[model samples]
Target: MTADARPSLAALSAPLVARLIDDAPALRLGIERVGGARVVDAGIRHPGGLEAGRRIAELCMGGLGRATLGAVPGTAAWPFGVTVHSAQPVLACLASQYAGWSLSHGDFFALGSGPGRALARQEALFDELGYTNAADNAAFVLEVDKPPPAELVAHIASTCAIAPDNLTLVLTPTQSLAGTVQVVARVLEVALHKVHALGFPLDRVVDGIGMAPLPPPGGGFLTAMGRTNDAILYGGTVQLHVTGPDVEAEELANRLPSSASRDHGRPFAEVFAAVKGDFYAIDSMLFSPARVTVTALDSGHSFHAGTLAPELVERSFTHVP
Candidate 1:
């Protein structure tokens, strides 16, 4: 698609939101009219179902593709999986899925991700991607235990240059089922971010697909956080189709997995504790899928990296033998 013909993320996702509201009102994923803004609560007040989680994951992709619930090939404790596919992988994953914004107001804070980030244009990554979008409406996904307040919603509206009524926010806490699914759904985003961090030209990436085990929910925040992180760090895998030089594709493939980091080979929870809960203190390269494959569309050559650490995944997931 040409630059001018590409649809705004919000525009592309609005229909999906409407479908959710209409099809599964019982899921309680609806538009909240607060302070003249609309907030879509996926997990906060209501118990967001697996289907809602799937839709929220798709929303995170800016509706560029789909995220479906399934199972990994050979896993027991972490059998559930979220499979993602997108034609515009760079635009859908990096431009929309990577949670790059830290939003806070008073005591409320959440890492904002989704179509709303494009509308806000608050990160330099957008500039580097040569992408900017504007829409009368905006949408955001927030990983938070509580719903955002009216003031925070208004602040987001102002940043997006949209009226409060034109904004939509989706909330999910790390400990919730929906939250776990959505985070695991970020397998592709994690791999793409790793490639970008390695200085790979993202424009060469034509398509992407990823899958990571969906962790069972019920633990407190930190435990749940660890399991989700381990789902990607130990069990996730991604395959990216790229139209780039074969050498560059090989380099990206080598560097695209979590094992490339010094921080690899441990449960992410242990690493988090070792860093004293300071996320920045840990190696940034640790946040990636367990395995990655880069296919050079031009040369018909493929490069693979890393290996799935199912032992670590079992260790982190449960105590059962």
Candidate 2:
């Protein structure tokens, strides 16, 4: 399809919404009417269970990718992993999966992602891609422990140019099973964001696939957050197929991994605590997959950077002594 003819992510993902709603009872994802908006509590205020978390992870990709549970090699404590693959990686990952926007109101905050971002068009990254969608309905994923207020829902509807009833909000907390699965599912997204940050043209990226281990659940918010971040920073691996100049693709591959950051040696939780829990204080470059491989489709040349830190992965996943 031509760039201008591309469908809105929200429109493209509507089927997944219907599927989730239809399987709501089985998935343990509770759906309810809140302020005329349809709210799916995947984790917050609901167990969301494991199946729901897996489905939500897929939904976060705007239904453009598949997210399934698998095993990460050499990891016994948190052996399960979230695997993601997508033909529309740019649209599904960077434009949809990456939580690039912070949605906040008085005493309320959530990192917003999913197809709703395309409708909001508030991020500067959207402008750079020349991508926007005019969908009559919208879907958003919020990582928070509490349901949003009615006013917040109304504000989202207005921003998306849709009626409150036409909006869908999926909520998941970082401490929950669903939240952890969805966050680790960002392996491909994290890689794309790093490449974009390094000034690579995203349109050249034709496909992406990635995998990162899912840590066992039990810890509270901070610990869960740490393990999820560690999963990507220490265990994740991403491969992108691009139809671009060989030199540029090689350069991107060289600079794309998390090890490229000076803060690569320690567990992410330690790094977080070192910054006194101020997320912004940590180096932005530290947020990426452990290994990245970029292949130039035109020249059949490939380049790789970084290596998986299984020791740190063990420390973070198991909290071992």
Candidate 3:
């Protein structure tokens, strides 16, 4: 946590780090430059950036065309481009966790200060097939854009050489934020899911979406997958939170899990800490699953894609060399 301090990977939150494999097509990565050096709003303005959900899903499932396209009108560009000196810290940290998934030249901020370029190779194949996964993908816009025009969408699809159906548009605002930063945050979250759902097998498509309006189990907002108790993308920043036993409770007990020991990873304690965590983790790990798992643990409980709150879960760590 110091200028001269160098932390190992284990010191970093697992959800906060990710990797992009060259072979996996289901995980198309999308990144756009924004206004801030640190936490500035620099999303794709022109042609906007790739839809987060769409690009990643395309990368994961395959059968999609090129992952990104555009520079079209109304989409704002980072005129001054990115400030590397300003973003050096996050850039370094993100590069470490997401090195493989990142563009070859460096971070998206690198894309600015010049014409845009696809950082990753254009055409690659996956070696694992089904296990194909993606890590460290991010898309950020200062102010969200509306869905591009039809022609623009077609052009983007053409640029990527994919059909219109295969594409999901990044949104823009015709109006103003009106102090509606919270709404922007919620929409950003929903956008991550809807687009990702496009790549799911037909039977699994239901898992790809949900707004937060409907009352969730126990009337909660954080529903699983596409189901939620409230309309997401509302008028406030939405913070995704999770904390559980690192290893299964049973497994922990077998070791030092004496019932008398303290719950170092209590959900309440973790949630309280999460409440204070900055957008650093909020932006990158909200939708990511590495830190927590989602399982439809109960078959009888019908989830229009229902999710079991990770709070009910526990974890155990095993050392392996």
Candidate 4:
């Protein structure tokens, strides 16, 4: 399909953003205005919880996907889990939810995600996908402990060619309940990202489903970030449906899981600290789900790889003191 034929991601996600604002009180989200731009505080000063995270996860996908929280058997203390699926997996996961845009001002830095990115097209990924969009309004999700500065907000609006009043930003801290859920909710996005990095044809990706055990929010930022990343690296699972030859599907499955990286086995925080927090020093292949299944649609066969490291998951989630 041609890029021009695609739906406007900003337009698709507008209603979800509006609904989040309208239901801010019930969701325990703080609705505030920053320099004429609307800010939805999912964790900062408010006690945003699971439901809010679920909704925010969908918003992160630009309304092109569904995120549901549930409990599966055999999870022990961490029984709760998050499942996400998208029919437009490529566009929803990579185009909108990938957290690929970098935004910074002074001491504050954030990677911007959600439908608003489709409008800005700031990253080269957009060009590779041959996708561009326009909208009167834009919505973004920033994994931040506080709202962005006015200058950064203004720059975002100008870049998207939208008014500040038409802009909405959602703030989520990694140590908060809402923040943990939303970040762990990126299980499917993590898979798609790995697939892209593997040089698989994005157009062949038809559908995807991903689930990960949700850990309790950690006591500090480092612990929280570790839990989130470990949730995917050790406890996450993904199944992708694609149109391709069986051999290609098998190859993709073999190469797609977190275990494919030499940096696997250890908790992500340890890995980060080992590299002195230089994310670039770590293996790029380490950012995938624990287990993966890729189904070749035309041939009706599925290939699987990797294993769930519940031992590591338990150690990571419970040992933080």
What lDDT does the true structure give each of the candidates? 0.86, 0.86, 0.22, 0.93
Best by lDDT: 4
Which pairs of residues collide in candidate 1?
none
Please, what are the lDDT tens digits per residue for candidate 3 over residues 71-153? 21111221111001111112121212111221111121111100000112221311211112222222212223322234433
- The weakest ten consecutive residues by lDDT in model 1 span 23-32
Per-residue lDDT, model 2, residue 96, is 84
Give the per-residue lDDT of model 1 (tens digit) for 202-274: 8888999999998777478888889999999999999999987899899888888999899999998889989
Candidate 2 residue-wise lDDT at 271:
93
* Model 4, span 259-301: residue lDDT tens: 9999999998899999999989999999999999999999999
Clashing pairs in 2: none
List TM-score per model, in order.
0.95, 0.96, 0.22, 0.98
lDDT tens digits by residue: candidate 2, 1-321: 576876668877888888988998887778888789999988766687767777887788888889989787645666779899999998898788878778888999988899888888889988887788888888888988888888889988999899999999999888789888888888898888887888788888899999999887636888888889999999999999998699888888888899889888899889999999898888888889998899999999999998988899988877832
Query: Which regions of candidate 3 are displaced past 4 Å?
Result: 1-158, 162-171, 174-209, 213-298, 302-321
All models, RMSD in angstroms:
1.8, 1.6, 19.5, 1.0
lDDT of 4 at 64: 94
